[model samples]
Target: MSISADSIKAFYKDGFIMIEMNKGVEIRFPVSQNRRLAVGTPEQLNNIEISPFGLHWPELDEDLSFKGLAAGDFGQHSGCPTRNRRPRAVAGR
Candidate 1:
């Protein structure tokens, strides 16, 4: 798939970041779901730069890719539960 982001917006109040794709597709996720971003202040979250490949927060040292976000991935290898992992049901009571 072609990876291109037209624009990116961060909502501090809502605690989510939104990425608008070139094809008019928008992807968003909670800031709390990311390792580096979860603890970032509004000021830190606000200091962001958007690239064709991903979103970058220099102050917070955070980066998120359009493809990753679109695929329901916030981050990995950070000890946080991935969005794609489903909880297993208990077999017996």
Candidate 2:
């Protein structure tokens, strides 16, 4: 299923992005979690486009799905080692 955002804002000072969903739920994630977003200036980060399927940062060339955000999946560089890293094989006993 696809989820869409009602509005979005970049709180640069707070170091996170906030999305207000149509269901009155708010989803937030730190900018540091995203590689492109972490490097964006306040102006660039604040410039957001909320589409039916997701959020877009044209200046940063980044797009994140609303469904994914709600699920705590903050793009490829989310700093969650388990999410981004490949599983290592265990040595034979």
Leading candidate by lDDT? 2
Worst 10 residues of 2 by lDDT: 2-11
User: Which candidate should be chosen as best, given TM-score against the real structure?
Assistant: 2
State the C-alpha lDDT per candidate. Answer: 0.70, 0.76
Predicted structure 2: lDDT: 0.76
Worst 10 residues of 1 by lDDT: 2-11
lDDT of 1 by residue, 1-93 (tens): 444344445445578776655556667778877888888888888787877777788998877776787778787435655546888898894
Candidate 2 lDDT, 1-93, residue by residue in tens? 644444444334478887765556777888899988989998998888877788889999999887788788888674555675677899994
* lDDT at 40, model 2: 93
- Candidate 1 regions exceeding 4 Å error are 1-13, 76-93
Report the Cα lDDT for residue 80, model 1. 53
**In model 1, what lDDT does residue 15 have?**
84
What are the RMSDs of all candidates, in order?
A: 6.6, 4.4
